[model samples]
Target: MVSIGALARLAGTTTRTIRHYHAVGLLPEPSRLSNGYRDYDAHDAAQLLRVRRLVELGLSLPGVTAALGSHPTPGAGVRDALLALDADLAQQAETIGARRRQLADLLAREDLTTSEQVADLLRDLTTAAPGTGPDQLRRERDLLELLETSGGAEGFTGIADRYRAVLADPAAVDRIGAWAARFEALAGVAAADPVVTEVATELRMLGPELFPGPTGSPAEDGGHGETAWAAFLASLTPAQRRCVELAGQGWPTCAP
Candidate 1:
């Protein structure tokens, strides 16, 4: 008979683990010797070795217990369990790979939040807008930055397509100019007006669709649409501001 400590050493496990296995019914409680110490015979040592091997092969304690038997079928069950674990691991690896690819795309455009495609679209819109100037260009840049950082390449790309369509029409420029004028007039009247606030909120909400971000309140930084718009307006010259102000009039609330 081997002492508990001796069995632990032979089985490459702790005495505590052996006791735990006995408590959990994974291992049978050994007979007590005259010295009040538990004694494990060859059968017990072989059972412990089998348990250790099953654990090393990734079988849970419960799984090992359920599958432990004298028949050759137990080996087949262990093999099947290992195969299932491998399949699960493979799935996790694929998911991790996909996430890494997405992160890589985001990192590559670190300098400009918007993708190249979205930036090109903004450039086209700026060029198409009536009275296009340095200020408008600057505004486009600011908007693109916000969209890129907030929505990501896919979202910015979606907005780019929409804006491109809107800008393609000959009459769209005048309409946009009129809308801008109206928005400026309203902005001048009351920055805190309910109507103005509602419009602003709507515009901000639309921004997320055009530029994706994690589902939450807008970032406290300049990622918010209103904040970006304010920056764009600040960058404009008085003449350019007037042009944008005219474009604001095309909005429904600002329309004549």
Candidate 2:
């Protein structure tokens, strides 16, 4: 028989830790001696050592108690806990490794501006529409950026083939470019001008091929109130608004 202090020393832990183990019901306290000093045995020393080892292995005190108190099999609980800990550690290690690799790649590059997905989209667009103006390219990139938020990069991947086909056609690209320029020209003109009607006709014809199908009714847009659609029209100049309104009249219930 030894004193609690002696047992703690043998177990390589503090006397406070040994008392904490006893208080938590992890280890049974030995009886007091004639001198009113707590007497501990070799078993107490061994159990205290075990608890310290478990704590060092990352088990909480409560976890250590649960793993040690249960004796269904020979140290089965401890083995199970260790295995779970190992698995968690492995997953963390893998995540860290992946981040390290990404960091390495970033360091290796000098002129990396956007994400890989955005960069790929820019490359594909350039191939599809050679000699596209900077302003037009920037506008296209902005549209794609919106798609990136509304739909994921995968959504762009799905539509890339179709967009590439349209961009590859010189006539289609020319028409789109012309419409863009026309919108700029119509910014200040009167909505009821003869040219508004003519532009509306062109829009009604082009909307079918480019926009394809009814976008929404005049009263509602995308099941939401016409507020958003109204705002969109309000943003356009009077001539552009008139052209769009005329086009809508020609193809009522259709939107493009």
Candidate 3:
């Protein structure tokens, strides 16, 4: 038999922890001798060692207790539990590795610019549309950085080319310029005017057919294409606007 302090030291645990385990009904309370001191026997030591081993293997107290009561083969349940934990940990590690690889590919040089360009364009669209706020802008920027760094540029470029073609179409250019003017007028009144909303809605509707994928189309992948186009249209200069208008008429407005 050993004193609690001696048992704690031998078991590499604190006396307070042993007391706590007793309080929680995890460990059996020891008998008090005539000398007014508690005495722990070999059985106590073995139980303490088992508890410690279970803890080290990541078993909760409840789980350890259940394993201790039900397991016919000594340490079998604990071993199975540890194996399950190991398998879960391995699966998580593989998922993390896959994400890391994807990030590495996105950040490669050729992919970066196209990703940013697409995101920046989307942000402009959302800003121009109603009920959008700074939170939306921040999210767009975060997504842009992720996609650009994530090697999504090939898909991005294909969408961008389609937008450029749309802008080059003489009829589309005239419509867009007229739409911009109407929007400018509406903005001069109330930024949230019904006309502004109408223009935004029209743009949203046409955007799907024009861009056609996650970077542009609502059908292919929600409103990513529409948002990107809105951003690009928002950033256009007066000269670029004119060029887009002229493109509709089958004429180059000016040199690129």
Candidate 4:
């Protein structure tokens, strides 16, 4: 027989844990000494060691209780509990593996947060239209994301679907690319610059063939659709936004 502190040291646990185990009926109550302190024996040490091992193996207190019955031995109950725990761990591992694979797929995308189908179409378009800068690519992605998430409502007029059909032809991709290059050239130019107004006015020639709809319907709709449209316009440069305002027939816009 030894003191509670010695039993704790031998079992790799604390006196407090041993006391808790006794209180919860996990370990048999220990003998008391003449000094009124608890006296622990080898049986108590062994039980505590088993309890610590089971807890470290992710067993709950109830599981530990079930595993170490009133008359515990090397029995089928212990094996069954371990088997159940193993099955649970295996399922958790599978779930974690699936989540990691999904994360890997998402991280692999250069155009993160853009819908997958739209990104595939954009990839083909970008390939056909070489020499487009990151800014142009990002803006186009933002537009595509907006259109896709909008659920093809009255605002976008299903222009996303129209773009899908048009972009399938390499020739259309080239034309869109060329127009984008010209527009991108005036990136930092003043909104009032003659080039800005000229490009804004000229957008009429390009809008129908490329986007083909009542273009400013989101602003006309007056709701979250309008807010989303404003955010997209706000993302553009001053001259780019000015051109959109000029082209979209009195669409209100902001730039910074």
Best by lDDT: 4
lDDT of predicted model 1: 0.63
Residue-level lDDT for 68 in candidate 2: 79
Q: Supply the TM-score for candidate 3.
A: 0.50
Clashing pairs in 4: none
- Model 4 regions more than 4 Å off: 3-38, 41-54, 59-91, 103-119, 142-162, 192-198, 201-205, 208-231, 245-256
- Give candidates' CA RMSD values in order: 10.0, 8.2, 10.6, 7.1
Between prediction 1 and prediction 2, which has the larger lDDT?
2
lDDT, candidate 2, 1-256, per-residue tens:
6988788778788889888888989888888889888987777777888888888978888788788767589799999888887898899899999988877776665425454555566776677556666655665565455444433455445545556666678788778667766655676688767888887787777663442222345343333324334444565678987777777764533333
The sequence of per-residue lDDT tens digits that candidate 3 reaches over residues 30-61 is: 89899978899999999999899888877788
TM-score of each: 0.49, 0.47, 0.50, 0.56
- 1 against 2, candidate with superior TM-score: 1
| Candidate 2 segments exceeding 4 Å error | 1-56, 60-62, 97-114, 124-154, 166-256
Positional deviation of residue 41's Cα in model 2 after best superposition, in angstroms: 8.2
Off by over 4 Å in 3: 99-188, 191-256
Whose TM-score is higher: candidate 1's or candidate 4's?
4
Task: Write down the TM-score for model 2.
Answer: 0.47
